[model samples]
Target: MLQRSPKDDTGDFLFHFSSIKIYNEHTLVAAPMGSGVYVRHKEGDWEGLRQGMPEDVHVNRLIIQTGKLFACTNKGLFEFDMICELWRDTGLVIGCYQLREAGGQLWAATPYGLWSRTGTGWHKIAYSHVRVYDFLFYPEFIILALEFGIAVYDRLVGVWMEFPFNEAVTGLAVFEGHILGVTENGTLLHGDKQGGFEQIRFPHLFLFSIVTKGSEVYACSDRGLFRISCIRDQITLISVRLGCPVTDIDCNADNLYMATLFQGIQRLEL
Candidate 1:
């Protein structure tokens, strides 16, 4: 959700929003690529939430866990202190790409590897040398989208199983017991936990993010937004072009929100 700051009357616009999230039912928070984080209430102007953060920090992702806002940024992992109205650095100073909560624990994907936060501090769990992009929990397994392929950690066995892929994966989602992943080159993949992934053809190129809502899966790309439907063994793609490059997308029960590369945030009514 990039735009001119509320105080900027010069008509200059900011671009390249990386992530967006609907928070607390009435607030919308967005992370611009290099401008830290911003928040906006319903129909209100966007406000910066950059206190205690470095100037021009790159925020890659945002997540709400335990009713608190956490940001994955170039500097480190930050938790927003509502009382102080500032972001508190959690002391994990690596470049974090994504954040997730599974089994009541907080996890972060980074260039170094996959890390989990404990009551003590952050610990590198696995893939110490590989870059992790995204992750999701499936039953007792933790599925990760890594630079080379998908890796599933069998919690019961305490070992990691690798599923080799040709392209680097950027995002992942689960739908109806199947794992769906979008590659950096715009390829959509579907497979089970056993690592048998097959490409699902779609027209969009340069996919940036993937998300799921109810029974539907949505992927945002340079072309626009696409809705994927999986019924029985048939897969369907429905395109809803917004005339701009959509970098990220999320949805709730009443609306769908999109963060475009240059067009700020777009909202679609449900």
Candidate 2:
């Protein structure tokens, strides 16, 4: 059941949330840290969807690829079975941090390495021992935010390139044909095609996640949710304060979903 409490002055709901993702078209899935995953269909109340998952499973991220919903958790990767009303483990067994789709394939980022599903088996692509925080798919390369630096994998040449960064990147997104990244110390960086990055001034600090929608890039930070415009050569930022710290954010055609540190999930009209 979805807990209802008094809203703050900024109209923010009060519930702990770890991440949020849009499922299918009308369904909203949210992970409230240790409480497991919950689903809300169209104007319906949120319902827990932890039937087949392990007890107290901690989901780190949620993603939809090829019309199927997947959850990255501490136990491993699990695919939601809509027909069965439960989650089935994908048998990857290693802890997954994030899941992404690029080059018409599903990719999983884990502490062990980056793995991809091929046929009925999973293959390791890169980053065997390094930890990957996030990744983005460029034109011909797969860009990764690793524990210590940035890595770019060229698909056409079948080569991997790495560039060291002073601070660890916690999130990644692409804007206006340039790579944008948020570092662990809350610095926003803009990178070119050659893997060189330059710092851009960002007001809010302690940013954890970032996502791009259309010509705008939204970043989640301790202060609030900052929306950056990618329209002009110079970056512009607009802060949307919800009176709480935001941890993650996602968007679709109609709505922008925010996962807050103390609030469960808030949906805003775009």
Please report how far candidate 2 places residue 118 from its true position, in Å.
0.9
1-270 per-residue lDDT for model 2 (tens digits):
224443333443334788888887788888887778888898776777898889878888887778898889988899999999999988887888888877777888887778898887788878888888778777888888888878888889999998788677767888777788888787788886566888775654667777776777787888788887755567666787547788887788877888888766777787
lDDT of each: 0.81, 0.79
RMSD of each: 2.4, 3.9
> Can you tell me which runs of candidate 2 are displaced by over 4 Å?
1-15, 200-204, 230-232
Q: Give each model a TM-score.
A: 0.90, 0.87
In TM-score terms, candidate 2 sits at: 0.87
Q: What lDDT tens digits, residue by residue, belong to model 1 across residues 147-255?
A: 9988888889888888877778878888678888888778888884455888866654667778776677887878888787766676666786657888777678888
Which sections of candidate 1 miss by over 4 Å? 1-13, 192-194
Candidate 2 residue-wise lDDT at 57? 83
* Residues forming the 10-long window of minimal summed lDDT in candidate 1: 1-10
